[model samples]
Target: MDWDDMRVFLALARVASLGRAGQVLKMDPATVGRRVSRLEGHLGRRLFHRSHQGYALTEDGLRLLPHVEAAQAHLSAAETPNDTGAGLSGQIRLGAPDGCANYLLPQVIARICADHPALEVQIVALPRLFNLSRREADMAISVSAPQAGRLHVQKITDYHLHFAAAASYLDRHPPIRQIADLRGHSLIGYIPDMIFDKELDYLANLDLHAARMTSNSVPVQLNLLRQGTGLGVVHDFALPHAQDLRRVLVPVFSLTRAFHLVRHADDLRNARLRRFAEALIVGLRDQVARLEQAVAQADDQANSENP
Candidate 1:
């Protein structure tokens, strides 16, 4: 089997579309389809089930994938020299919850790409968990690590959050001496059913419910806070973007969560992915530490001035 054909097959399997695979390979769609056809003829197994939903992988294809992925990993490793002089080149897609994607990954990825000009990074920020098994993304940052699956997980960093609101909203509202006062304010937070992970259920820790304003996206929630719509749990790292927002019940309420770096098991053998993962882990730790410190210092300054 031609290695080039195997690449086309993998690309088609991943994206589930001829045009998308072709674009990734910089080849014509017809050429991509032809390559898949040739590979099927060579292997004597129909790899994909073609339909309106695009090319869904067949049972045979599913069985063949891990072997092919292993082979590809080996090939990629062999291509890397002992000195590793070449700049990291290739696309690395990361699936993350919007909080990290919006507040953290941009700056971290910026530095990564700056150091390696050839590298390309794509961040998919969604409220739901990513299916890394299906190659939804090469890597994922999750609130909690998974216990099952042929995968690798690493704890990136633990970050903090607090019940926070814009200064304008705070000034206009009744003083919040304790959690009980929250009942009088418009609570902005995730839609109850839309909380994808147990860790994302921020209000539950405080025995609170019924957010008058809700969204699945973190940025949307943050925007609601920025607009003085209401006070809600906000990540400390996200505070830089909304400097006007201030923590409420800081002495009484706080949430700590960690970000986990997850990747496919087979990626352990791929030198390029390993390098990218290392850089990503380091960058995330640094960014979280740096952002949290800045927030703490600002909080201190605010309190000192008021006192």
Candidate 2:
């Protein structure tokens, strides 16, 4: 009913234990239990299921979590005074697919952190859609803008991808002059069923299969391609990281995909998130352009030398 009661609820929901929640809130275990019971009684709906294991959120608790978290965000923003000569003095987390996380996020984060010395950032790189409602991260970088959710979506930038393979693999295997020539060879790529976004199904879009070597991580697939084992589609920004992997069938197989900045709609009023999102959007567009230029220059050099 109040911020104090919601605070107790949130602490217990996170740790799922009375003693642990007490430790977090600096309250006695008995008091914590009492607060939870009192809150539940006020609502006339159970928020948690208590057992020997721990306190698990009931259906109602899950539904209540986002609202409480939103309130907490507002309070957190208010507590940290802005214009204190300390730029962005709080931690913000970002969830992103592994490809961009590995290849692009480091430099961009470096710039943002350099500008905001008091800021802290946690990067959660996984091969899945982050649950913004649950506060999985303050924001997420998605390959495709989600059609469903109470969120703000921004198209950060467009990046490129192309079919590539290690030099040794190409030398040993038959040449792929055309898409039809990709027979009897499997491309290294994300696990088909594990691809979190349709934009990442590069091979599937090409009517090609990737069963020989696969992983949920883009870095792992990139490494597999670097090993001269098989061919695969790779991001242009990532090509610079592994020199041995060379682009092939570039004229025949290339793709352009966009990265989207996604955040909860409730946080739009929060100044900290708004500032960070702007910096992120600007930095990503610049980085993608800079990296794609490098890829193009490298391709030009390769052609001039060979021809």
Candidate 3:
């Protein structure tokens, strides 16, 4: 019945390892084990199926999770009376695709850190799904909108990508005035089968056979492009950093995808999380003009050619 015991229970359930939970809670492993045992005793039921592999939540534990999370959210809301989020301070783990993590987030996070000196932001730049239900990340910027889950989703921005090649590479290769010219060029792209998210299947709609050189990491692909390895789809936002890269095929070969901001529904009431979400939304909105400029460059090129 103690909130402190429930906190221990939540921590253990999240990590599935007493040592890890203790690390998170800043308690000794033995103390964490004792607290879990006490909570189990008070409830008159085994919450975790203990094994060498680690703790697995029982059905009762799973059932209790939602209620506990709700209580935690309400408690957090109660403690932070200033809903404006100016006084918010806590760690926020954000999972984002490599491109956003590397190029987009640094400035946004830097500003957030300056605004709230007490807040810490951790960026996980993996190209895969972030499991919000399991608390893998407090929030995520995803390539695709989640179809179904206990999640809150918002469209962060619509960003564009175009087939690009290093100016040096283009100088050596046959001129590419059209999409068909790409066939004669060495293409750099994602390894088809290794793409975890359907949204990342950039080559699928291109009708291209396969890449001459491929990498799963977007940054790696960009590096390959920078090295003049071949033509590859590059994000518009990334162009600011890679000035040597030239947009090829003009307006004819381009892709636009939406970035979504997602978080667990239960954490919606937590002031710190809410504040970060607001900051993200505002920051991304402010970059809309710059984000769209890459696509506009292609249009300019096309118009010049036609004229």
Candidate 4:
């Protein structure tokens, strides 16, 4: 039994898709498929049931899983000492929401890379959850903490969001005096149906009938807000770049969401992964004050009245 073949098998089993497993392995889908087939031939047993959706483990595959996992753990343990001395030299796939990836993580990741040049960090920015159990990401920055999983979870930071719009739009439109006044104006937000996480369902808490413009991407929503399209929930960290935008209903309409750091239990034991996790925590902690700052200036007229 080839260890490399087992590694491919584990990646496929965890990700359940050839493309994604290939991504983890830095191989093409065709290569991953071939490798899996080769491994099955070597084993003389069918390991996976292939479908359009993804590959699922056969009964035999399930039976083989624990033994393979134990072997993997032993191999990882044996390599840890060499890795610690060699410096951080492996890839880490980090999954995060667009808001964090675009606005916050790049700087942190860049710094980490600069300090440890051999390390490679792949950022997967999407609206949906990353399954740590499946190794979708080595580490994930999630909106909410995981309730159940063989994972290590920690609160990274509490970031704030506010109702914001381009100054030009607010100036041209009727004043938003109260929550009810929102109905009379055009609003921008996430498409309700496209919201993957319950924590991302910002519109549900508001007195909103429909959004004037909707997008799954936070950057898109912010762009529309900057274009003077309509008011929408904007993260404070993103406010610094869009000079024309201003937060409306600050303090009152502001929302706080916690970013949690999550990693699979097995990966947590890896020296490289532990170091990356520490770097992420330190990076996020450094941004605490900036992320928590009020989006609007104190003297702004929008801050004076309740709307």
Per-candidate TM-scores read 0.95, 0.83, 0.87, 0.82
Predicted model with the maximum lDDT:
1
**Reference-based TM-score, model 4:** 0.82
The regions of model 2 sitting more than 4 angstroms off are 1-57, 69-86, 173-175, 207-210
lDDT of each: 0.89, 0.86, 0.83, 0.81
Model 4: per-residue Cα lDDT over 1-307, one tens digit each: 8898899998888778999889879999999999989999988999999998889888998777656766876777777765555557767789999999998898888988898898888999998789765556778999988889777888988888888889899899777757776786778888888898898888787756888799999999999988888888888888876778877776467688989998877665566677778888899767655555534353254447744
The runs of at least 3 residues in candidate 3 whose Cα sits more than 4 Å from the true structure, single-residue gaps closed, are: 13-24, 44-60, 81-84, 291-307
lDDT, model 3, position 126? 92
CA RMSD, predictions in order? 1.6, 3.6, 3.2, 3.9
lDDT of 1 at 166: 95
**Global CA lDDT of candidate 4, please?**
0.81
- What digit string (tens of lDDT, one per residue) describes model 1 on residues 1-307? 8999999888887778998888789999999999999999999999999998889888998888777888999888788846275688877789999999999999999999999999988899998899876777888999999999899999999999998999999999888979988886889999999889999888875656589999998999999999988889999999998899999898988889999999999888888988999999999999999999999999899989997
Stretches of candidate 1 off by over 4 Å are: 51-53, 81-85
Best by TM-score: 1
Deviation of model 1 at 84, angstroms: 2.1
What's the C-alpha lDDT at position 24 in model 4?
76
Clashes of each: 0, 0, 0, 0
> What is the C-alpha lDDT profile of model 3 across 1-307, one tens digit per residue?
9999999998887777999789778899999999989999999988888999999888888888778989999998998877854655756779999988888888888887898888778898998889876666788999889989889999988888888888899889777887767776788988887898887777787656689899889889998999988899888888777878888775577788888999889988988788789898888766755656755676577669867
Q: Is candidate 2 or candidate 4 better by lDDT?
A: 2
